[model samples]
Target: MSIRILTAALFLAIMGLLVAQRFSLPPELTVRVAASLGEDAGYGFGEGLRRGSVVETGDGFLQLTIGVELENLDQAKTILWLAPNTRIELERLYEDEMTIRFTRGRIIASNETDVPLKIKTNYTSHLVLDDVASFVNYDFLETIHVIPLSGSVQVNAGSSESLLTPVPLAIHETDPVTFEKLEVNLEAGDAAEFYRWAGVLTGL
Candidate 1:
């Protein structure tokens, strides 16, 4: 083969490898909480918490902040659930600092007690919300990690579908659901648009 042809072939092969690596790598989602008034300090990642460490907000509410690793703004919405009364503010981070604000929503807290929430993702699925009935809905299946900000959540895999179910609670709460598998390309910008469409369809 000619030197020019060989060089071009090598370049193409390198590009392919880079693209594959980008898609195969999983992103990390970090969650942080502030110390409550009169409290000594807050919990960090992998820290043990008491049975009832979560405290009620002074305004008759509880506040929890979750930092999710999303390919873009759209994917962020899939992993977040905002109650009507609960306020949600989206902030971008750069090297561990809030850099920009993307979106925010308010979720209404139904009961005073803590509610179970679930988030599920895998190599073949995007972020999925689970409730009691079954796999209610799913976005593109491209997520690599699942992070639960509050309560207990579980993820189950099956043929043609994946299940995300919230653990039962002592009080009345929302039911967990599962999601159907959908093919999505993680390396392209289209993934962001796909999640945007999902958010609209799910009213998120």
Candidate 2:
């Protein structure tokens, strides 16, 4: 009967949708706030966040009052640690690329997948290499201070581009350094280790 055929078609469509979702990249990232991160920190991750919250891409900006860890789903396999007082937005997400807009603050990024992670700041955009640990810091005035621990990052601003090794790239916001090689006294991995946070954290 015509009714039976229509029901079968509807069932087939549902199954097809399910199959597609099963193979696609997960649309959300798990947010974990440490117990020490005070209650104010919860207000920053405000996309209907709860314990073990999973925030989807483009949910809105996350302005943290304390440091928190964002872990991608098992399929994506990436982790981002957002430092305190940091504000960032999940810019875009795709099967082959993931991007984050750095409004301010620091992010310790570890990308495990081959999908290139792109970080966009006010002055420049950086392509984080796969399997590399990167320490990205964007302050209110300093703007940029990226330290690649192992691999290099493709720093781009408009048509300019450069693949920079583990070197200090600290510059004032007015003087944005895009393609040029910035040399600082600190070697690679030293900044990430010795760079001090502004204040001490004490839990009650």
* Prediction 1 TM-score vs. true: 0.22
- The local distance difference test score of model 2 is 0.51
Candidate 2 lands at a TM-score of: 0.54
Report clashes for each candidate as comma-separated counts. 22, 0
Candidate 2 stretches greater than 4 Å from native: 1-40, 43-76, 134-139, 171-204
Q: Can you give the lDDT of residue 196 in candidate 1?
A: 35
> Model 1 off-target regions past 4 Å?
1-8, 11-13, 16-30, 35-64, 67-156, 160-204
- Model 1 lDDT-worst window of ten: 104-113
lDDT, residue 157, candidate 2: 62
Query: Cα lDDT for residue 100, model 2?
Result: 76
Which one wins on TM-score?
2
lDDT of each: 0.29, 0.51
Candidate 2: Cα lDDT at 141: 59
